[model samples]
Target chain A: MSFFYVDLSVNQSKTWEKLFFDLKGTKRYNKYCQDADFYNVFKQIILSLLLGEEIVLLDADFSEDEIKRLTANSIYETDDILVNKQLESIESKEDLFQHLRQINKEWQITLYTSGTTGLPKRISHSFQSITRFVKKSENHSSNVWGFAYNPTHMAGIQVFFQALLNGNPIVRLFGLSKEQIFESISEFAVTNISATPTFYRLLLPKFNQYPTVKRLTSGGEKFDEKTTNALKQIFPNAKITNVYASTEAGTLLASSGNNFFIKPEFKGLIKVIENELVIHKSLMGNSDIFSDEWYHTGDIVEIISQNPLNFHFISRKNEMINVGGYKVNPHEVEEAIREIDGVSDVRVFAKSNSVLGNIICSEVVINNDSLNESLIRNQLQTKLQEFKIPRLIKLADKISTTRTGKIKRN
Target chain B: MKKEKLLEIINTIKKNRNEVLINSIDETSDLRNDLGMESLDLAELTVRIEAEYDIDIFEDGIVNTIGEILNKLENKR
Candidate 1:
């Protein structure tokens, strides 16, 4: 009853109060019941809160069958694959609450950077650190960003907390096709939208059939020229923007509402240490848990803008793929391939090459349901810088996505 | 576009277009569901709207809401 559970079957969009009623009527959910209301997950979560258990809420897109399968088979038990020495799980709701509350006492949040580059990193966020992003919705667009990413991820978790405190309307848009997102938008009269380049890029071609959007926002992955232009083409003239937040460092930098931004000064001095930009937050990692203010943001961005801090994305310090003398950012090649029409999504990476030191290889997601290779190749030729072009492109029916919405990059 | 004309345009894009006309959306009916426009449909609808309204929306400064879009359409007339 305390949870606001949405009824997906109903034609009407339920207000939080209506959802609260649905929750009241619903029985306590075990992890397995298919069609179990997501709000039930909240109830289980709240129940876990009272009982001191750390419950991992998977994205609702997973069917009951899938949840049963994954929970039964997931490799969380093995610490071997845990990135950044973060394999250990904390026990109890009390453990999380204490850690979070103490952090909240002195700080506002602890966000984990998406592991798109290499490994996920933990970034400390004071209430002040996220002021822009916290009020991010109210200040920019009115549309609620449905938990587009996974709650297990930092962005999703932050959005969850932000929506809870702000009373914003955000449904979990798991497994729903682009069609469903459009439905949610019009149904909610949604005015603001946030998504990754892949999410929007995949949905862009379909824009030819949808209603006009009010605001469009994207981040996470490479928000390159072709993707931005494609978004513009789809939205016509929606308020489009991006941010450059990382996990190890929270909100270290943000782009202006326009694609370009002047990198803001850190509370502490920031510098490009050994070509890798190291930013010093007054505090970094987990909580007021650690007090080291000077932290290196292992991201390497070419300093194109600074006063208002505008920096062009160069490459991740560790993810740079060198081809002979040519330094290639995986994102750069992905962006190039993305520029190619019919290329729905791309994951470009380095492979051992005899000619080039590390040759570029791409896994491309296309609407092979209807493919026109010539048109795409032509488009890629025009938009992409020669070296940035992928040497090989493999068409995929579905790109392997992490449990989170992020495409698996490794 | 007149209600009937709008209905016709929408119908061509959707499977059951007459149902949309029968539904009769004004400011309240959500185009995505009440009218049956999916995400792809919305993208297509905007293209139609842009062609019909002869306006540039979905940019940095363009109006981005349904109500605002409707108001813009009304004003254009």
Candidate 2:
């Protein structure tokens, strides 16, 4: 009676037996445009990979124009060599699991970037590269995952592979409200949760502790000390970790805290050049953007220790706003605002101004209505320089997020 | 009325920094010299005024005095 996935929104659950049953006769598409339910999307990815076929995943909420732009208006076109391959039926769930564990093929999975800074780029990964960080052990079999990322993105694919390979049940928690997310976590007794810092920030000002969660993973955005501390309070029993991954590359580094250390096996595969993290071409997916041997990650990291080779993310290189000749990192400003009492969430960005080429601006979500622009400005004045403090502050009911759950920069 | 509103905005910015508030302002008062406002402060003043009057006082070029801001607003009206 092992369950595959549980959908709290519909109050429906699917079993491992049903997954195998559906896979027996499921129609396989070489280049699938999956804008369907989470169960179906997961099922299609598994079926395609099992048959050694290529698959393209698109966000379910993407507009028709966006889909056209991503696919170059060729959604139904397939250039895959394995387009005509037949789907093989497995006799039992054990056989399916065995196939997954022993599977090695040239099957490619395509994913689009969240496009926070500019247009999303399409990157393709081989089966081996996508599952390079997936761990399989008897201990992992008992862990229940609270899936909280978009199924079409890189982080979600990593979670799916990890859970599927370990035979763990996943409780869907993406796109759920703060109250609903907690409700699902308690109801399912979810043990492991992986999501962005923005997703975790929405659950701030904690009310009740969920001791069932034993592990929490933060990725896709900067995991600040404030959010990490709040997560510790909510998931008191969980061991929190941060994973560094991207659309261009799958999971590469994992850290117990905000600081990351390159594993001994991956020492040569990763390096830092002028503050930007660089990855070897061997570790990245197939994209024209990686013509060089080292792919510039465009992420700026601050080195914390030289002996242990420890570093932590600072901010994206493109995220720095030039405000009147002063470089302002919005993350720094946002962190200062987050430390202030009564603030639920804050998004600091740049606004085109006639005076300063670009002026720092922020939209803040606060629990206390008495928190006003001047009060926040005064508090920030002590922590940040005059140019770093946002020139314009707007109170928002909630901070908007991209399709991949990262805070919307624009 | 616009002059009073501009004075209030200026005082709010001053109050946040614990600076002495100015009760009255004239058209000839220099923003940087007389009011002791820096470039960042002027930037904030630009946005606050844009929010209130729907006009960017520094859109065309740098405005060094309250008279320039009021003139920008008056032109918009």
Candidate 3:
């Protein structure tokens, strides 16, 4: 095994030597697997390498049957593995490598897009693409990072590798509240932090106490004006940067001033065709998705000053409401509400909130006057996550549509 | 102004909001996570807290954790 790989599993007892031994013994993992790193980190990384297989990251809370059913039709159907089996199989492997040449250059993982507008799409990522932007240095050895994002997603994976590759300690923040997370960060002396703008908002109230946080990062949602200002006021000494990256396009741009300008080095990979930020196929993880040379990001950006690359993100092409950094697809919410018997036609959209960047709101055309707000809420609770469910549901006579006959989102 | 009275008022509000079960809340419990209270729910909570205590806890800023709310109420009185 190479020195690049580090064992940052839930248990610190799992060593790199043991990881190498486990990696060598593991067979081809062609089956569907959840990439949530709540347990053994080395096991999953090794399994991905040995098999050179793609791992889909579903919400960790997803049931075993749900995982099996989702991956049944995919290539991972035959030898699919669950969360527990993934760890056990790796720990059970014996043949350890003394010294390995290099990691697999092929695409190692498959990440699903947020699918805020529609159904989530599978995007392939290679080791090179994923680690392209991680600035690895021993200077970060003294720093302990807070693993805030869902480990299965792109941001989470980036933070994991950034700390692990440098042999830095990481404090897991999943299932922890804002207050608890702050306390953990303070207790652990966490120096580096990365999370979505919504996560930052939740942390703002208690942010002042964690003075040890030397680096701050925000992504996964639009790095809005309010958040940038707040972050500056809160963590004045910290080097703050809002990163712009997607599952399709691995890390793209960074904005220290809240106006994300395409970095000078990656200028060749970026293009602004007609207002939308289009990237060259080379920058994207899945190049095959692009029929043309450029992949459309669907995010509208305004170019302020060109030289060193200065641009500001306007808004998403589709009106996707980001609730506390979690992408809530309006269509999915509408579909869930539509399933309720009385709901005739529902148009779901985003309503801005001071704390949470956006909240899900719906205008519904109900058939029965007897159907009440609580009935709709009760029905939605069974189908959707609490964040995805609309905060306000109002009965409308009809849904307003544009000339194209599509429901108006704005 | 006692802690017990404040807890009672909070439990009643949490029960009515349907954000969380009354059995789940406690002094150390976070209002957002434990009660699943979003900004709107927090706003509703603020209204109830004000009505019960006759004090504007949120006049300073947003209060999230249950402990913070109790402290604010105690200090206000």
Candidate 4:
């Protein structure tokens, strides 16, 4: 079976045979820190998991400072533990599939949160928990995925496992331009696509309908009616599904439309406390941040019904700013602005607006006179999603701080 | 002169999004349809216009076209 498709100009598309050939020659690592292209990254994760090795997925675009913080200075270090897997003996594609099916239960995958509040936190998941929602049926074998998330993130991992377990081919669509994404969908005859609402928003003002796409899934962000209507127009044949998941919890609730209903099995595990959705510890990944039996998801939801417990996600708690209907983490925006060359410090907060509930505003302190509001906004456009970019940017001599020395939000 | 400044603000938001720029706009130009401005774009336009004219064009009601925005600014003056 085909493995994945990449840009032909950069590298040749790979197949299961190529993956097998590479697997035989590759040296295994107990704890791998992968920062590579989509193909190599996916290949490494598969190899590590099948061999029962721990792998830390790092974003390719993460700055060195971010990497140092996330890895705790162990960026280049690998464990010296002995791994006794005889992957080389596997000669055929069937053998490789057999090996993949029996994934090592001890294998752990670590992922970092977007660090919306502070430094990115480590969340480790067992192989079973990570693939909790994966469906492996004969009907799923022929589906092709339009991979559209950063491979390091939880959403990407979910899509990867779903496609991998079904032995389905995936087309690389993350970080690609709108035109490139459209081209890949048609060229690959992609049947299933799962991405954040932001990713689908980039394809807005629809021009063409992709008949080949049969299933469309949106998660990681709020799905609005305008976008849903636009997607319906663009992919007439596709059945749209919305998923509610988090770094703390894997895929849990899904709906064919806006409101999500908790499955009967998950009724006791998931609940809403004071409008905030909470998940029982059994459904979550291991993290130090979770201290209580019920992990407070920080996601506020509006209950639509009580009998079946159907609800719609409203907004995030505390520091999250609701801009229009999109949730923007102030700290995430602050982090992006702080990456600008001349930016010394920045404080991102929300300002009330008549047009969109709230508009993001930032007060930036710069080290150089050459940096201005427009220049910084232009730079931020590259690093952040459009909704996260501050609409009103004010250059300041210094950011006002509280007595605790934290940047003041008010 | 006010309309010119407003057009510049609209173009700035358009440029950031990599959308087609409009050379000229009249009172009949619909912000959402003709100018292709979304809610976020409208928010940016409000902030930029507020910065220039010290008025919230969308404070009283939702303005659909360039004419409505001009009327708001004219009333504020």
Candidate 5:
């Protein structure tokens, strides 16, 4: 278990530490990712866990020996070694203003996301923006929160960093599990839960079980009506909220409950041109992607409700798969796929096609092997638009994900 | 039986009907072809199905299994 030290009292010192064993002895838990090496990675993890080290800078382009060279420069109480992992990979050039900037009366969070390209895009958040979302739940209800996304992933990691930084407790199931989440809710008395629309679906079955939970928040990807309605019904006592933001942009747009009410406190300015969402660069506040005081949100939203706020998510621009002349947003088609039973994970992409110009393809990851390709395709026919359906569906042992819990889409 | 159940699940999800329609979905559908499901959605659905139906569809599965999933969900009812 990795632990970090936090000072609870000025006169005294405080440290938080815990040991975690893979509850699922699904032995493969230790089977490392192809992303990094075997030895140094574990070495770094052990040192960081045993010692109270918060940040470990990794240089992806650097050799392991080079990591050791940097480690020599690292001054920590623990013999923590640096691994060429996410901390290094999320690296982007820091703004020189970061040196000129003085932080006072506010907390700051540095955000790095896996954006449209596989590259990690970094953004900065003031205490007001990132933590403000978490604090918004103060007047809310919930018994437990499930924090399962990898911390290396910008969205999930923020949860990991903040849960401790804010003195909030959380539990992680081996993978995302409603059963495990329900168990944790009862076990830990958790009330507020945060997840991506994808992760929320994992725990969909457990909502009815938690009488104490009243707040459910989702981010990282699109949250559609089906998902919103499902969460509303499952946690009838809870409020379901969805936020639209990129790693480069943070906590930008939020919708509340089944009403999907947009929050009014957002200072960001938005414009929709040709069904695309655009933002004034100045609206980013302390964010990085808005260098010129304007940023284009590659998302589509409509002004659905005006009483309490401004807009609702309509669709996505990045999710668009160029299929010949027509641009197909993957999220638009993904909604149709979420209903099928026994299916675990799905991703849609466009492949060059001589006839259609580009044909859609999907990679499906499932635990059940009995259902074959035809059954799935037939099922798709019942729910999805024809062109949105995948031309081919390949079985994936596991869906490849960036450290940020987002599927790697090229 | 599988095809009928699969069709039912697809219909329920399409409506935004607050229900966990499929307790067990697998490779039988070209998930993209049959259900248009993505990898993250599939993973999340697997957990919800397991929790709602109280089924152990993950048994004998190292990653994700169609054979094992079918065997487990078949007797869930």
Candidate 6:
């Protein structure tokens, strides 16, 4: 157990310090925050629970309609936990530490994932399970981290805990524009950042210079080689690591280079069975899908070699496009399109068709005027089969992504 | 702009979306709520309708329902 203080502005600091004592916890709960005001209070409630209770984190957005559905279906009631109140109480740090010592050490948190293919699901993790990958050294305490995700999200909570656990300061990136993000980073002298590939892609052009960012991490989406190499050029001093993780599973694999390999000890814990990545039930926390010996992560992968085993992530099993009878992986097509000259980024999706069942549709972003429909189709015809070629292509100045930075395939 | 051709397009969209088609779809059918058509589904519907009718309904702006698409096709003719 650790006791720490968040360095907020004077007014908010006093408010949060009061919340540290007045806040309460429950057995299991669903947390939702509408905007930043709710987020500020919601985070403090989580902090109080982390110090003093055994709780389970439920999955759902902070939307009223979603809450209505969850309440109707699940055991949750809207009145079970309310957040509109002002918490004003105070206790000394020594007394807070005493209360923290009596709390359950095995208390767990469930991060609900908003997956691309279907409805969101809950992913459980203990404090140990989440902190397993975080660097335990005190040297990182001086680093100021930048935060961009919802505080309740896995990636977002990871940032908060990583900083709070190590006594570091975190600056929220919510509601900041492309320009404002860079400005705040410079203003705070943020030394570390962990965001989705989409976030970094948007920030690259706006980020003229930021000498303070030293440790960078990308997760919650596919990390491509092109973006990795570009970031390397920009953040010369930052040690960039791309990780492959899912809500069903915690941090499974990570690598700074071209490919991600299953960690040596986790070799048996994780395996690619019939091209689909599967993890031992021990890795996932309290999920119902783990009745079998291994939980099948629907993510697909390709094994590269044997002796020193290596593998590359493909696309999600559901995200694969079936044209007539032939299966076409979107990642394969996206990779082919990226190789073409002047093509900056591309998102390939399955466009439903009457005769073909589903046809390939691509949204291509180009930085230069050299790309056209015929030029792209001609280039892809050489690398891909005739059936795999995209039938509909839209040229756009930019590609849009989900909040977590994955290409919005839906 | 025959009703048969328009029904065929709606049915194709319904099938592609894996939604269960109740009755035969008509011009009055809601594309979003009734047919469960998303933005991606709407995009493909635009392409197929363009190919079949040789006129783009989305040329001017966004098209919402099956009725609006039929109106656009009729106006183009």
Which candidate tops TM-score?
2
Over A13-108, each residue of candidate 2 has an lDDT whose tens digit, in order, gives 999888877876654354755665899899888877787667889988788888888888787576544334344546665777877765557788
Evaluation by TM-score, superior candidate among 3 and 6: 6
> Highest DockQ: which candidate?
2
lDDT by residue (A1-410, candidate 6, tens digit) is 12232223221222334445545332333433333442354454455444433343443344656545533444343333434332222254434435434546656666557655455565667666766667646587677777766566677767766775565656656445776777767776778888877777666543366778898888765666677767777677789887776666667788885477777878678888899888898887776546898888888878897546688778788887887678998878888887776777888887665445677888998767876876787788789876677767789877877655578774
Q: Local error of candidate 5 at A22, Å?
A: 25
Candidate 4 lDDT tens digits, B1-77:
87898889998888767688889999999999998898899998998888888898888788999999998889887
Ten-residue stretch with the least lDDT total in model 4 chain A? A401-410
TM-score of the first chain in candidate 3 relative to the native first chain: 0.66
Off by over 4 Å in 2: A28-30, A79-91, A102-104
What DockQ score does model 4 reach against the true complex? 0.41
Q: Which candidate order results from sorting by TM-score in descending order?
A: 2, 6, 4, 1, 3, 5
Better of 1 and 5 by TM-score: 1
How would you encode candidate 4's per-residue C-alpha lDDT over A1-410 as one tens digit per residue?
Answer: 36554553354588877877887777645464557578888887887877777888877767888888778788657555544567887776567678877877788999888766677889999988898899988999899999887788888889999988788887888767778889888988899999876567557655788999999998765565656776889999999999987778989988998789999989888999999999999899998998889998888889999888989876667767888889887766776776676765677888888889899999987768999877898888789888899888889866665321235565
Model with the higher lDDT, candidate 4 or 5 = 4
TM per prediction: 0.59, 0.94, 0.58, 0.68, 0.57, 0.73
- Report the C-alpha lDDT of model 1 over A1-410, residue by residue, as the tens digit: 12232334344344555543443444433322122354554444433333323344454555556545555554234232112311123343234334433332332333334445443343444444544356534453333545565554455555555554444566655456777766765555454556666677666665553234556656665577766777677666476767665554444444534334533445235665565666565434454324555565666766654554455666667678776567877876676666655677878776554334565656887755565433444466677655555544567766666655565645
Estimate, for each residue in B1-77, the C-alpha lDDT of model 2 and write its tens digit: 99999999999878867799998999999999999998778888888888888888888788898898888888897
Tens digit per residue, CA lDDT, model 5, A106-145: 3344434544464445455554454445542343222234
Q: Choose the strongest candidate by lDDT.
A: 2
lDDT value, candidate 2, whole model: 0.86
Model with the higher lDDT, candidate 1 or 6: 6
Query: Which candidate, 2 or 6, would have the higher TM-score against the true structure?
Result: 2
Over 4 Å off in model 6, which ranges? A1-42, A48-51, A54-62, A71-103, A306-309, A339-342, A369-371, A378-383, B1-48, B51-77
List lDDT for all candidates, in order: 0.52, 0.86, 0.64, 0.81, 0.50, 0.66
TM-score of chain A of each: 0.67, 0.95, 0.66, 0.78, 0.65, 0.81
Give the Å shift of residue A294 in candidate 6: 0.9
Reference contacts reproduced by model 6: 0.00
